[model samples]
Target: MSNTEIEDRQFITIAIKNGLVSKEKVDRAYILQRRIYTQAKVHKPICDILIQMGIITEAQKAQLNAARNVLMGKREEPADEVADDALPDINTARELELTISKDGLQAFIHPEHHQVQDVRIEDLRLFLNRRRIKFGVVDDGQIKSYLSQSPLPEKSFLIAVGQEPESPTPPELKFYFDTNPLRIGRVNEDGSIDWKDRGKLPQVNAGDLIAEIIPGNPGKPGKNVTGKTIVPPKLPKIRLKRGKGVDRSEDGHRFVARTGGMPQLIRKNRVQILSTLNIDGDIGLETGHVEFDGHIEVNGIVQAGYRVKGASIRAKELYNAEFEISGDIISLGGIYRAKIQSNGNLRASHIHTSDLTIFGDVVVEKEIFESTIETNGQLVIDNGTIISSKISAKKGIYANDIGTEASKKCDLDVGIDHRLEREVNLLKADIEKNGKLVQLRKADIEKARQRSDYLNTQLGEIAQEQDGYMVKQRDMDAKLSEAEADKDELQIAFYQKTIRELGEKRNEIDAIVEKYLEEDEGILANIPVYERDVAETEGHIEAAEQKIKALEIESEADPGHPEIKISGTIFNGTCVTSPKATLTTREDYTHTSMRETDVEDGVTTKKFRIKTTSL
Candidate 1:
């Protein structure tokens, strides 16, 4: 029987046997009896005595312990509600938007929406760039919007925010992680599929047994570090036991304390709370998650589970704390005690302050701690020293000076410091020392503008003085125009006269030749030989004409349609063609650039070309 059932049966039997308790009272007294029954130190005889004494009931203790067990973190909790899915399930995958801003990147994290999370400032919140987003830090808020509001710290520790969105999938749903069979052999234990070993296909026992992870928990081995809690009331000694008489007697000194008394008496430094906070988990004294908005500056050590997001954050101390961040971060300290992380610019002075893992660009005025920095822009250092901070930038990193190890992609850059120095100088020269320069510039601009009016007056005086010259220039231009027109007319007329003269000369020569032919003398005798040659050419032409006629008759003709003319031509080791349809033949034509192809494996090179043809 269940513990409750056994306790219930015991309570009923005791009441009935005693013959003093009424049935209604026995029912009500079940809970008090159960507590006495379960108290290991107390005897079963004592429990029966308690039931006989009408002190407690079985059901009430069961209910009480059940609540205590849950509070103690000993019981498995019912399913917790996962965060709500916030990403819209819009049908269209791609969308675009545009807006204008006077403030460029300072006020805006990204120029375009997609590029926001990809954007990062140098050296402040280090780990907030394109590569390697701060893990365990994704939330429902739009990542792009976060960076626009602030710039990362120049040399600061990094922090990340946690607030994972709700699960979109329903209960009983399955998910898969690795599908690479070569690297990690596939296992089909998801909810949709049956549990099957590699290359084997039958189902396993029940769905619950099909989980892929091996069965083991730190319940007995590794420190849970979860269930322990500091007393909820900061000074529980003063608060919880105040009215309940003097709580403790530590040698005439009464102090409010737990049921077991103060930890000081036990000599345990870490104050432990017997009570539970949300299932009685461990109080987060050394290492745990941190979430904040405005600004976080830590003077003490941060051990681990270090996630911080805010408009700005400054950590004086860090030791082995993982960080995810959305905004700016700065740290005066080092990370030898912990690993520092940031989404935005991360700048820290010494190794102890910022041994960093940066997602954004790193701009360290001083030495970079032994850490990995990945950024989208430039890795900059104001000082020429880096103690093994591995850096990578998507766009090439520009360091003012290249260190010996700069060739190794992961090594830090010495050149980054020079650029940083120039930046500092520029800032100083551009603002602090530019007052006199600004006044000078304004005076120069005014003088130049006044010179324009002065030049206009001088131009008028010069124009009057050069009036005669201007008249001469106008006459010369007119003469030049007239001469050009006359030359064109004369050239046309000369061409016509030449043609007429040549015609007359040809007629006179023909007449003389005819006279010579009639006299049967000299050149006229050779003319008959030329006539014979022409007759032979005519005979060849007649033969070609007959062959062409026969071919034309054999060829299929389409009427009232575009004509296809065949002419044989070779160009660039291949055939030349005008625009022609399939099966149409083509030949000799002046090969224009468009008509010629460099014939590669008999494939036609296709390209569009523009050419001007005269009408």
Candidate 2:
């Protein structure tokens, strides 16, 4: 190539490396220069084309030319020796394009299209230094080998590589128990769930290891192509807070269980062991019939077809399940078709077709439908209906409504002790039996009196016969002394013996009559005693009825009144009952209250009345 051509190429390479102009724009300028030269047989410099095309300004061109002169070691020649457009070249080294990556990690050198001597390693180093790539330069031997090729390689050559920054390792928490223990069961190949294999319950025994902390390292620094330090990010420290029933190791690196119970991870970093089994999800077949000795908390629903037993229970909803809880139960969502027996109070949103026997008070927010509920304390439905259900409360029952127009009949009984009522019924039966016994004793006294009268008449007949026999015996005795024949004397002796036997018979009949009189008196006396017993039992029954009435009156005046208070409509087919009376609705009544009150119908009687009032 001519000296002018080489100088122009050197200026283009320097302009591109300095970011004054892009390689693509310079290439286009070169194409235009070549086309003009071919069409008009004229030589146009690439620098002038680039300037005319607005790719580079004249000032930028001049600057690039100065830098090129310095890089190529071109000394200024005399004006007499060099033409105005021609450049004086003192060296014949090939020019190269240096490019550094955006990350400052790697650099490449592109060989230009020139047939000249190989580039010096010192010049290559100087070129990289100008681009701020002072680190990780290639060895001199490698650069010589790259330059000694038969034809200089046209592709880019990797001249330098920078060190990558090392990142710090993050702190790790390694739990012995499963962190996400409350999960659904595994799925089989046929898309069916293996409910028996519901994920592990993170249970731990006393002194068992629960978790451990793994320390992290602060990573080493790295150097970039500019020889600047790249510091790694700091490792985050993890802290574990010990909760109830949890013990930490002396070094604070290990967490252990202090009691035999389930382990739970709470608030992101706390490790706790709880006596209560905390189920984070639903109680379904996947959880497979929970039976816990302590309290149970279900975050989701207690699904259908599950049996759960616990000391206490708290759930979002209960659906077609059976629960036997010794303590109180709280269900946020409604209960449907569930059978629950709680010794303690029950609080729920609603109850539908469920059977509940609560010893303590029951509070339901919404409606209750087709359920059988018996409570010793009270049943309260604050804002909803008690439709198609049977409710019996010892203290009282309160609800917005008793039944619905389309629902089945609802039966409610309040202000009475069910046990005491049963006892009264038994006493009434006993009273009936006692009255029968009194009648039977009166009949026995009459029979005994008849027997005594018959015996006395028989004694009278025997005495009359004895008197005649005595007269005959006296006549026989007077004749015996005057008799001479043996036959007459024997006859008189026989008659006297007969008279004595008649007297003995009269005495026996008299003794039998006396015994009958005593037996009649005994029967009559027993009749009075039986009658007294019947009277005492009747008195007891009356007393019990009075006590029940008094209790009903007291319950009506109780703070939690033993009555049905309906804020909304109470429909037909609803019956409110007490121990003594019942009130069945015949039509819908709005904002009514039902309670047992005493009414005088000839005698004082307790009756159930529905009074319309604002609730």
Candidate 3:
């Protein structure tokens, strides 16, 4: 038999033998209790079952308890009483000898002075204070655990540790560079400073973030053994100092260049931006290599084997100097045996360079011989000879004569429309790419929004279902309370079963509500990310569209026209080029004009003839 069944049988036999209760009443109560336990898994005591079923009374249970106590030979518990006149005191149960290190960074104690049980936490604190070792504190539990170890402090054990003060961080300067400084001079492979460009000029653009003054960090205060605060020495002040052509930030943290110029750190303190570095004489050992931020003016020739860079240059003469220029160049004398690159227009009396690349228009006054020239704008040569040179221009090429009488070949390429065309095509391609991306981003945002709406609907439905379950549970509780107050056994049992069923329904609703809320939170979080993606994609699409429109306008404005007018005689063996065709001179002609014209065959043809009127 089960333990519960044996206990029930023993209790029934005892009650029947003592004549305290009848077998029929006990059996009825036991059957009811078993049915309740089997249905709901609620195990009620036998006395409570009997009382609920009106088969036993409280007075009878009390008499039975007295009899049971006598049979078991047990005594009852006694009542309590109060005491007066209690005194409070600190713990002084044990003695400990504490010692601090010379630097006040460490504190140790000897645990052999007392037994582990006799050690007191308050007495240890008092001893530490009296010895003026007040920086670090060891807890009571840690001390007790340490003392419990078999190894006593024959070697003193470290308990408390003090903190050290942090040193000050000095201020420094940070540079914002646009060009690689290492490329200016000879650079080493290993990661060490190259002093070749130590005094080299540093360049900056207008409104450029030149340098930032990193503020110094103050020292942190520390505590000594006696809890005395140790203050650190003050650090030197560093400022964001500026000179002419330089500006400082409002917060005094950054130094910015107000004008486009070369930066110079003078007197180890202030920064100044020199807009133009003037060289009165030739660019040689006297002027060093030029690397200025703004315009450069060389009154004399730039010698061979040197590099000169500037925003714009007005050199009287240039010879074999490597030049990287950003603005227009005006060379009054000539250029010979040099390599030059100009970001803006170029004007030179004569160019005999091996390589010349100009982004803007090119104007050569005299002869351009044995050179390769590439220009994005118009190529104009005034009464000059282009001998044995390759010249290409985006707009048109104009020269008085192309080749010499010695049959020196000169290649000329004009009517070049690819510059603006390429830009327009690239912009169109970017627009299409960004458009597709925007569509994809829009779709993603819509999908997320739809999912969010669905989740919100589910959340609302769950909330409604939960509200109904709550109402039913509350009603069941009220009915159970009413039944218990009336002392009606049948009503109480019926209401208890109803309440249990309502509780199970409420639990199901709670699980559903929790699931809906969690899914809703995830959807809400993803909504912002999708929204941001959509916005960024749209912005890219708009920017690409604007660029395409601007390039289209520029391409429309580019008209390819080639024109060459000679004031003097054009010799034989000279080659001339037009937008449509090339003409080779067979004989000398005076006041010659070379141009393109539409022929009757509907193809544009080149015409070279002696001019009667001014073009």
TM-score of each: 0.20, 0.34, 0.41
Which residues of candidate 2, in runs, are more than 4 Å off? 1-360, 365-367, 374-377, 383-385, 392-397, 400-426, 453-471, 481-615
- The lDDT of model 2 is 0.71
Give the candidate order by descending TM-score. 3, 2, 1
lDDT value, residue 103 of candidate 3: 67
lDDT of 3 by residue, 441-504 (tens): 7787688778878878887887888788788878878888988999889999998888888788
For all candidates, the clash counts are: 76, 1, 0
Each prediction's whole-model lDDT (CA): 0.35, 0.71, 0.66
lDDT of 3 at 424: 71
By TM-score, the better pick of 2 and 3 is 3
Error of 1 at 506 (Å): 99
Ranking by lDDT: 2, 3, 1
Give the Å error, residue 169, model 1. Answer: 47
Winning candidate number (TM-score): 3
| Local error of candidate 2 at residue 87 (angstroms) | 99
